[model samples]
Each structure stands twice: as C-alpha cells, then as structure tokens.
Target: YYQEEFAIRRTLISCLDWCDILRIWDVDALL
Candidate 1:
C-alpha cells in the first residue's frame, strides 16, 4: 500500500506539471 501511494503521488505531480505546461502554452497563444 505504501508503494502504491508513492506511485500515485508521483503520477499526480507529473499530471499537474503537464497541466501547468499546457496552460502556459494556451495563455501564450492567446497573448
């Protein structure tokens, strides 16, 4: 269970980072 939680946390971080990058690109395009 500990390992599963660690994996989930890592995945969430990666997803958040990807989302941030996408948002930045979208804003740049709008500007």
Candidate 2:
C-alpha cells in the first residue's frame, strides 16, 4: 500500500510539471 501511494504521488507531480510547461508555452506564444 505504501509503495502504491508513493507511485501515485510521483505521477501527480509529473502531471503538475507538465501543466507548468504548458502554461509557460502559452505565455510565450502570447508574448
């Protein structure tokens, strides 16, 4: 159970990074 929970947290962090990258790309395009 602990390992599964850790994996889920890592996946969530990865998605957050992707979201940040997308936001930055959008801002760059706007500029």
Candidate 3:
C-alpha cells in the first residue's frame, strides 16, 4: 500500500510539472 501511494504521488507531481511547462510554452507562443 505504501509503495502504491508513493507511485501515485510521484505521478501527480510529474503531471503537474508537465502542465506548468505546457503553460509556459503557450505563453511564449502567444507573444
């Protein structure tokens, strides 16, 4: 159970990181 929880947390963090990168790219494209 602990390992599963850790994996889920890591996946969430990675997804958030990707979202931030995409947002930055979108802003740069608009400019």
Candidate 4:
C-alpha cells in the first residue's frame, strides 16, 4: 500500500547518509 511504501522510504532515508543514497541510485541505474 502507499502508506507502507512511505514508511519504507522514510526508514531508508533515516538509515542512509545522503552520499550512500546517491550510491544506491547509481547502482540501480547500472543494473
């Protein structure tokens, strides 16, 4: 559900530093 996704995104943002977040997106683009 949308709420579940929002919670997951919030947790991910809290857990990862900004640079780590960019790295994750970069890796996803590579895949």
Best by TM-score: 3
Candidate 1 similarity to native, TM-score: 0.86
| lDDT of every model, 2 decimals | 1.00, 1.00, 1.00, 0.90
Model 1 segments more than 4 A misplaced: none
Candidates in descending TM-score order: 3, 2, 1, 4
Model 4 stretches with alpha carbons more than 4 Å out: 17-31
Residue 29 miss distance in model 4 (angstroms):
34
Pick the winner on TM-score between candidates 1 and 3.
Answer: 3
Tens digits of lDDT, candidate 1, 1-31:
9999999999999999999999999999999
User: Candidate 2 — what's its lDDT?
Assistant: 1.00
Runs in model 3 lying further than 4 Å from the true structure: none
TM-score of each: 0.86, 0.94, 0.96, 0.50
Worst 10 residues of 3 by lDDT: 1-10
Error of 2 at 14 (Å): 0.3
lDDT of 1: 1.00
lDDT of 3 by residue, 1-31 (tens): 9999999999999999999999999999999
